[model samples]
Target: MATLARLQARSASVARQYYYRNSVVDVFRKKENDAAVKIQSWFRGCRVRAYIRYLHRAATVIQKRWRGYLGRQHYQLIVKLAYYTMKMNLYNAMAVRIQRRWRGYKIRKYCFNYYYLKAYLKAVSETNEAVREALEEFADMKEREERKADLEKEEKKRDYQARKTHYLLSTKQIPGVYNSPFRKEPDPRELRLQKAKPLTHPRPKVTPKRSASLRNWLECTRARSFPRSAVLPPIDRKPCQGPFRDIAEVLAQRYKPLEPTLRVAEPIDGPKEARAELQRQEWTRNVQDKLFLPFSSYHKSKKHIPAMHLSSKYGPDSYGSQHFREKNPERWICDKDFQTVLPSFDLFSEYGKLYSKAGQIV
Candidate 1:
């Protein structure tokens, strides 16, 4: 009985121990599963945050690049606008300068005209006053002489009548001398007639027709030579002096047919050919020191040619050789290894030949 009871108790104890061990293992497994689930959730959350951060960073970089591109484009547009504005300002300034010069020219012309007219008027007034005084003196002298001649004729009337009758009959063939009233008249008692000396001087001859015609033409030419103020007014006693009507009149006659004013026309745009020529000249100058001088120095020393001949052929600065190479590079080749292999000949002759060949090809 004692052996049976001890075995039963030991079996129960073993069963209880196994049950506790299994429960503890179950609890450990549940805690471990919960920890694993929490860990996995945290890991997943971290990956989502990392992905969001990466997206935000990429967006910021893209926005910054876009803004920079836009800023550069706006800056370029502003520069172009400024350049155009500057060009227009320069054109306006040139136009203004031209207008100012034209205005100055007009003002000078007006001043000259005003002064010249004033001087001419003063000269004309003086000439007129002198003419008037001379005419008045001549009139007074003529009146006195006419009265003396009348008194002498009255005193010798009778004598003069007798002499006149005799003289008329002797010198002329009268148609009816006997029936004339003057033949019957008696001479005045106080008359004492003096024999008149034969009138030697004939009536002043009238100008020939041809000479009369030329008089006007000569007067016109004379008038053109002098200023208008120099000419005197026509007076009965003396002829008018000098040529032309006045200074103003003379100037008007001379200038009427000419253009009144001049203006500068706008400058024409340069031709494409001319622009190309300018560019070519600029390019030639840029390369001249670097290329032509070195080539010329090498050619003169190596070829044993006279400096004068080289200068004549290539010009003082080897212009011909450089020009030839620039215009027709295909005709002349330069080896990379050989720095002094330029053709040895008169530069002018070589250039002439090349031009002739080119002309023929064209």
Candidate 2:
């Protein structure tokens, strides 16, 4: 029974505590606190909320102070403007009043002076006419004298211009001498320097000599430092240009035709051999075709002549293994007159070809 009683007491105490915690006033207070906490949480934390509130207060204070300052400045500006406007109005009024008084004075003075001048002019009319006539006569005389002086000066200027410098130099002096306005007379006792000599000889009467001009007398001058190379050698570029056309034809008869090589040629003695030789000759007829041989004068695929032929080659010979050069310098300049001239090479090759062990055609 005592344990049951104790349990009942604990239950009643729990019920009372629950009722107290869940009361209407407490619920309202808790709701208000939750709302405040929610706002604080939205600001990141309690510290952040306090900082934001403080900054808001500070900014409001600063804005209020700034508005007040602006109001004070505006008031001051308005007061200054009003004062300046008043001052300007007062100055304008004073100037207007002074101008009125000055106008009245000027009108009075003008009226009085007009009368005085009219009476004075009426009194001196005859005297003024006489003075004017005298002045006109004096002006006319002065004008006539001035015109005569100007004419005399013009005549003197023209005479000076017409005078020759040669005559001045020969006479050694100027007549009716006037003091020079710019040129001061030389002091009689001052030390004097001699006149300077002429800058160069008088302008040449004859033209100067030029080397390249056909009409000029000048020619290629001999350079003593390089005497050997300075010799005037006849530069005959083309042998067939001037006088060697007929001579070449006549000299060509003197030289013997060069021997042929056995790079592509074949001989036959029998009927079957002749038929094979004819077929071989027909196949080699195409000059564009490149065949491997002992030597070729040109490249296989290009129109350009290859340097291999220009070099000294011991190419094959028909009669014997005779060595020969593709380009002989003695025959290059004038070979038509030579006795041992080589046969002319064809556009592609008559006998010249590339040497290959396989003897394949490309």
Candidate 3:
């Protein structure tokens, strides 16, 4: 019982301690929250006051700009109105001046025309008097000619009547014979049978021979010649001789073969192993080591093979190695005994001739 009580007392003490701690924490937190709220409120108030001041300044600026704009607009309006009014007055004055000048010109023109008409009418009247006298003479001549023509016509009619009477008396027609007005005698059979020449001959199929006149004209033309003032370029017609001995000698001296820097042994002889080793070294240095330079060994970029490059199963490096024949027995066999030989292309063949000499395949 005593142990249980002690345990209970311990629990009670722990509970009291937790309560005190929570109360203290709550009190501190409340104080902190209150202080924070006060500080935030103070900052908010400062911001609000600043914003209000800014708004006042902005409003003042806007009002000032608006007022200035209005004043400028009014001034421009007044200036334009004055300028337009003055311009209108100037135009009115110019219009009046132009009108006066035009009216004066019209009056002067009218007076000139009136005086010119009076002079023209006077001249026309004088001309008309002469014309009237000439017309009377012409009328008298016409009347006399008409009378002469009437007299001739009467005499002709009388003579014609006399002739008709004589012809009627002289002509004796057989009774009951009807003479047709448009009758003509039949042509002789010989004349009708005669063949007439064709008016137009058929054009020759062959081209007509050049006329004598055209030939003569061609012969008359002189040969064409260049103008005397024309200048012609000089041309060297003589065949070129061989180079001069002096030039040949100079060329020989200048372009002679360079002397050997190091003497190369004739009939070169070396051990097969050493030669092969040197060849291998050269192949590795030239083909393998430097072939793909400026690129990492693991670069994914492919090597660009030329269109004409031959593809082989064996790698290029192996071709240089001494063991190439062993590595690629088929290549060696083909190179030596089983070489492939392509037949020569016959250009005369149909397909071959499809490609013209100009390399165009049409």
Candidate 4:
């Protein structure tokens, strides 16, 4: 009996343990299923909300487009209405203008003419008989005055003719020199009087030496440092072998001419050198022409005639002349510096253009 009881108790404990474990597993499974169900419901809800939002956005876009279309239609309608109204107003104003002009023309042409004619007729018909008699008397008086003027003119003409005929029939006497009443007759001896010879006086002849004596004396008396012969003695120095002619020569030799690397083609002393060369050539040409050319050739070559004296104030190429500086400041003659000096430029040259570049003239 003891053994059976122990076995039955052990079986009952095992059954209870199994029942507890099964209940615990069931509780855990139900909780997991509930959580899964909740998550699925939340996901579905989110999808539905997203779809609703999408529908709202699509509807908003459609509504905006519809509103824009309607607004555009309204705007077009308003524009058409305004255009038609403006056209109608313009036509009406034109019609009114035409009507006004037509009415004014009709009134002026018909009514003014009729009124003027009526006034004129009334004045003519209301005229008095006394005025007509007075006008007739005035006309008769004018006729009588005209007739009197005509008779006076005829009398004057007859008197002129009678005077002319009487003068023509009368005899005229001409006065002779001997019988003239204006002057007494000259004596016969005075008429034969001989013309006396002009009085003679001798004029002393003057010598050139006498006239220039004072000038020569003054020149002799003036002081001098040395004899005139020693003052202008010619030098035998060769070209480019003398002392420096100007500070420019020194600068030219010191600062080399600009190379072709730069756009500026000339150096600082280039203009000075060019001007000096031009002056030297001009002087040489003038000297040659004066020595070799005939006197008649001077007129043609007179452009480079040597000046008697050099200007003391300004250099040959300087432009500080008071006469032209103010009048033409931009002209090369009026420039303060000799920057515009060109070696080969000539105002009289015919075989050149007004502008030149790179040996090509345009």
Clashes of 2: 4
Q: lDDT per prediction?
A: 0.59, 0.58, 0.59, 0.61
Report the poorest 10 consecutive residues by lDDT, candidate 1: 259-268
Single out the weakest 10-residue window by summed lDDT for candidate 2.
189-198
* Residue pair clashes in candidate 4: none
lDDT tens per residue, model 2, 1-362: 99999988899888988898788568599789999999878867768879999999999999999999999999999999999999999999999999999999988877567778888988799789999999999999999999999999986664444342212221135422232335476422111111212123368688875333222212225332222332342345333332322323322332326545433243223434776888899878867665444436555455553486665446664344432334356666674322343444574453333323543221
The positional error of residue 120 in candidate 2, measured at the CA in angstroms, is 6.3
**Cα distance off (Å), candidate 4, residue 140:** 58
Candidate 3 error regions (>4 Å): 1-23, 26-31, 34-46, 53-69, 72-87, 94-113, 117-362
Q: Identify the runs in model 4 with alpha carbons over 4 angstroms from their true place.
A: 1-21, 112-362
- Candidate 1 C-alpha error for residue 185, in Å: 99
Each candidate's number of clashing pairs is: 6, 4, 0, 0
What is candidate 4's lDDT per residue for 283-355, written digit by digit as tens?
8867354343345764766544445564253456445642233334567565455444355434444233333
lDDT of 1: 0.59
**Which structure among the candidates has the greatest TM-score?**
4
Report the lDDT tens digits of candidate 1 across residue range 75-184. Answer: 99999999999999999999999989988898876655776778888778778878887887788778777877777776466445645554333323542333354555
User: What's each prediction's TM-score?
Assistant: 0.24, 0.22, 0.24, 0.26
Ranking by lDDT: 4, 3, 1, 2
* True-structure lDDT of candidate 4: 0.61
Model 3: per-residue lDDT, tens digit, 1-362?
99999988799889999999998899799789999999999999999999999999999999999999999999999999999999999999999999999999988876568767899999999999999999999999999999999999986765555443332221135311122334464233212222222234469699765332323322326542212233332343332344322323333443446443112332223334577888898777674454432355655466745344454533555545644233445656454333233443344333322434553443
